[model samples]
Target: MMCDLETGICGPAGEGNSEMELIDLTAPTKKIDLYYVTDPICSHCWALEPTLRKFLEEYGQYINLHTLMGGLLEKWDGFADVSNGISGPGDVAGHWREVGDHTRMPIDGSFWFEDPVTSSYIPSRVYKVVQQKDASLAPVFLRKAREAVFPFNKNISNDQLLIDIVNSIGLNGEEIVKESHLPAAQESLQEDFIMAGRLGVRGFPTIIFLNEEQKGVKVVGARPYDNYVQALKQILPEENIQPKAINTLQHVLQKEGLLFSREIEELYNLAQQDVAAFVEKELAADSYIVEEVLGEKYIQLNQ
Candidate 1:
């Protein structure tokens, strides 16, 4: 089966639903090991950013999150995702627009029309190289890559844009770009693909939770906030997991640096109608910079 646009499940044509793996954790460091399998260009993965951020903020103390790239599109060879009603790359434009509208995230989806990406492998490999260089920088680089493609209409498969993103994170963009072309980067991405296959993963935004006993549970798709919280609770029922309130924009932006109005709305517990007013207040009162993109407001802390 092809990818389902409604569920935001992007995978190969014939992969099954993800089943939790019982891999042996050799003296697991944390109470839970979270393998976050996602794609840089996956629409649902982009949608999961807000909820995923809250999950990490609230329960990050008890979990060790490992990001694994799920190979989504590898040179779309006349490929059509029948399940999602996408005939080609041009079809993705409208679908992603709808996704942005529903999720309240700032996604432009115009890249598919302006300059469509041929393969996700290039950017994914760049991320793998970044992951190899510095695990901390990889997340930021990936986020920028997503922001580039989804909202900014950047073709991340290109080397120059990828280099710019690396430089933004205070890393040596030239050195990293040079290494991303090597075989090792591809190998690292391949390893992730093998693991995803072993786990029977069928889409992007698949989170696998494993406890000390090596027992695992899978949470698939861009689900509601409670679905993620409950998944963590299921694995660590014995331990007390009090979800920290997502009450501060400064705290969240300190790490992420950039956030959209809807993202702040979700984290701040504001109603959809109040999103504009809340973001406007934050900008006008506290002196934050808001960048408008595709009819959405993105607040960024002054650097």
Candidate 2:
């Protein structure tokens, strides 16, 4: 996939198609298979986190979500994006800042300049290790890795850093790292790379929604929330497939273990300041854990 500097997608562009038809999901219970193609260090994927989470939260019951690593950066050794004129890690710092501003996702791009990740392959492979062990943990590790790199400037590509992220999620980090070196984990990541190619995916943030018959509608790029919803509707056209809604801020907090101001802003349609006010109220209730980091808030149930 050719990298587009303007979009931060290392792939060809795909328009959201809403074909009219219903195919039975292969899984007996779910309606669609959502294949999420993302990378650990993809700034655009990081920008997409809130929208992706809200989509899953509302429709997760009807969908089986699968995480596929896109291997965004094999190595920065000879990397050069002519369109964006980015030849190395430092070149991406400003672009990340712009993405953060545009998406309302807090991103500290200083890591690109300070603790640059030479390759995203390491974390991507480690993701395969976790996925091989527990499908649930794979996405959890992916989220944590992105949280570490995007806002905290942690080098996700580093060995120790990847292990630490794994450890934070209750895994034996050293064992996981050792397991990652095994043939199976690396092979798993390679399979994803091959699948991405076969699926005509050339970039980060590419999601293909497939019905039971395997007919798919691909939504590419960091699109608005409506685009994704429309794509899902097109695939299933069933009015009953309604999005699940939360009645209150506390309800939402109860659903998600951790909440970013940006995530809550998207989830409940609240302004950033209002998120602050509501979170403040929750904090005063004495049942929430709120941490202020780099001028932002991370809220979760105290338990």
Candidate 3:
């Protein structure tokens, strides 16, 4: 089974749903490993940011998370399998608009119309290179890639754009560009692709939760917060499962230097009808974070 976050729906990626199976409750206790298979340009993967952040925050102590790149779109030349015969950027842009409506995630579909990406390989390779340089910086760089494509309308496939992202993250852009072509980077990406194939992954944002015995419980799709909690409980029933309450805005601001209103809403499980207004009010009162609008309204810690 696969979960496409872009459509906020869980279904078989292709052919059959044979991969979906119940976790073995009798499995021995061991450290959980979460392999997050996703593509940079996958709108559903972008939509999963909040759920991912919450997952890491709550179960980080009990689980080890590994992000693997799933090459979603290799090329657009012969790609016509998407809904409504997606042949060009215009069709993809329309799909992104629909995803934004469904997930309530900030997505400026203008990227496809303004500066369309021909392939997802370039950014995926760049991610591998970043991981090679400094493994910790990988997540930040991935977020930058998403921001560039979805909100800023930048072509991440371009070398210059990739360089800009590297520099923006305080990394050695020149070194990254210089070694981006190294065989190791390509090998790392290939390994991810091979592993994805072995795991029967066919969609974006497919999270596989594995135990010490390598037994896995797959969570497919952009599901609600409860789905993730339930999956974790099923996998590691012996471990304490307390989801920390994000009771204050300061907690979020201090942890993540930058903040989005939607992120806060999802992180806190806020039931407020107008999450934007609530976030705006919080930002207005906070003396620590300064708000800015870059396609979407966001807050950064006042440095």
Cα RMSD for candidates in order: 15.3, 14.5, 14.6
| Candidate 1, 67-185: lDDT as tens digits | 99998888878777899998778899898989988887867877787688888998999899888888898999999999999988889988888889999998988888888889998
User: Count of backbone clashes for each model?
Assistant: 0, 3, 3
What C-alpha lDDT does candidate 2 achieve relative to the native structure?
0.81
Off by over 4 Å in 3: 1-29, 245-248, 272-296
What TM-score does each of the candidates earn?
0.85, 0.84, 0.81
Single out the weakest 10-residue window by summed lDDT for candidate 1: 20-29
Clashing pairs in 2: 11-202, 24-212, 25-212
Candidate 1 structure, TM-score to reference: 0.85
Which pairs clash in the backbone of model 1? none
lDDT of 3 by residue, 1-303 (tens): 667766555876754444466775533345688889999889988888888888777667667888999987788888775555687877888787778667766677776876788788788988988998888889889998888787667788888888999998879887886677678777889999999888878787898888777777888877777788888888887776665545466667755557666677777777535666666676655455545443345666565
Span of ten consecutive residues with least summed lDDT in model 2 = 12-21
Candidate 1, residue 40: how far the Cα is off, in Å: 0.6
In order, the Cα lDDT scores of the candidates are: 0.84, 0.81, 0.77
lDDT of 2 by residue, 199-257 (tens): 88977789999998888899989998988888888888753577777446677665446
